[model samples]
Target chain A: MSKVKIESEKCKGCYLCIEVCPKKCLEVSKEFNKKGYHPVEFVNDKECTGCGFCYQICPEVCIEVYK
Target chain B: MNKILSRPESLTLIQHSYCPGCGHGIIHRIIAECIDELGVREKTIGIAPVGCAVFAYDYFNFDVTEAAHGRPPAVATGIKRVLPDRVVFTYQGDGDLAAIGTNETVHAANRSENITVIFVNNAVYGMTGGQMAPTTIEKQKTATTPFGRDIKRDGYPLKVCELLAATGGAVYLERVAVNNIKNIMKTRKAIKKAFQNQIDNKGFSLVEVLSQCPVNWGMTPKESVKWMDDVFVKHFPLGVYKDI
Candidate 1:
């Protein structure tokens, strides 16, 4: 299975990763960070391909993917 | 498995003040990665410009100096000349580099100063609220050109790479974008090469990044990326404009 880690504090909540993810395993959290933006969460690690597309598309460089 | 992605050590830990999805953060990371990978962080001296990236000094982990508006190239030239052993570079935006600093840029390139320039061409005066910039495409709507830029009045977009290529002082000049996975990777490689050229004592080198300004462009981040690829790319035409 693949896993994704997010540094919530670094996330700007642009959500570009969710839009580009092929697996749809990520979702925006209801909680807000210090910046008051909803950080994204990995909802289903089992569905992740670890393709690193999310890692590539993140402008803030806040996401990590592990296979 | 190992850590796949993390903030580069060359970048400070402070959260960026850039708007969400701004390209400045990505570009900053790329520059930091290049410096780290090249093991030149300690020797790198970055000159921050007077635009959205004015706060670059706060984000970079190494020594950083702020230059006057549209004067990074000139400032970088002075620093690099004095400290030839250090890795000197300038981080500038479209408004600062191509508009007000046009003369500085051309003359610096003409002098073949051994400095790396990372020019972010987002097509608007971002810090000043989306005013028309020299890099703004003709017919693009900006605060100063609300009805779309007229070619006759505004002139055409300034092709920095092409302009610098003609000066012969620029030994390496490439334009890259950061909208997709492949392009982002290419941008990283391009940045590294530009810095490497400076390290090798080559003449002036510049990497013009065709970035997206979502807030200024009045579009979503995705739409801004799309427009950059579809419309902006057509005008700029990415590739190595000059290489030696």
Candidate 2:
């Protein structure tokens, strides 16, 4: 399964990654990070193509992509 | 399957200081990725401007130096002149480039200094509380321009790429945006080319990135990007202004 790991501690909750994810595998977690922002959580149930679009668009470089 | 993407090796472990959804981090990553791809990180020297990216030296792994407000091009020119072998580039924001550094920018480009320029044009003076920059679009609301920028009084936004393209020394100039995935990819390509031009001794090359200042723009990161697509691009269209 393709997946992207998000560094929750580093995420600023911009959601740009979620906007660019083709697989709909990324969602905002209810819990806030150390920075007081809602971090993204990967939804493993969905199949990810590992397009890396989220990786390219993430301003904080929080996502790491794997296929 | 293994890892498909990760942080560029040219970047440090320090987290970016830019606000969420700001484009500096993204641009910084793109530049780092390009330097890594070109295998020039070891010899690369970045000239950091006095703006939101003042801490650019901390983010980039290679050698980086700070320059006065809007003086990066001048600083980069001296560095490149002194060490012709090292890859030198300057990263400046709209206020630093088109405003305070306008003369420096014009002369550097006019002289065709063998240095790469990464011009981030978010239209406002982000670090200074969203003051009206020279590149701020017509009638755009900025901190100084509460009633919106008066085109009759303030004049049209300066098109840096187009302006520099007319100079004889500049060999390449491209304006790009980072609002969406396609534009982000295109921006990456443009940045790589700018670096490549310097390495090839092809004279001055500038890549004007239409970055997003979500916090300063008083909009969500999402809305800022959308506004860039809907309104910003209308004022400053993207594409190569010059290539020779």
In DockQ terms, which candidate is top? Answer: 2
| lDDT of candidate 2 over B20-63, digit per residue (tens) | 99999999999999999999989999999988999999999999
Worst 10 residues of 2 chain A by lDDT: A42-51
Candidate 1 lDDT over B57-137, as tens digits, reads 999999999999999988898899888999999999998999889999999999999999999999999999999999889
Model 2 scores a TM of 0.98
Query: Which RMSD does model 2 reach against the true structure?
Result: 0.8
Overall local distance difference test of candidate 1: 0.90
B20, model 1: CA deviation in Å?
0.9
> TM-scores for all candidates?
0.96, 0.98
Give me the runs in candidate 2 sitting further than 4 Å from their true place. Answer: none
TM-score of chain B of 1: 0.98
Could you give candidate 1's per-residue lDDT for residues A1-67 as a string of tens digits? 8889999888888888888899999999999999898999889977888988888778787887788
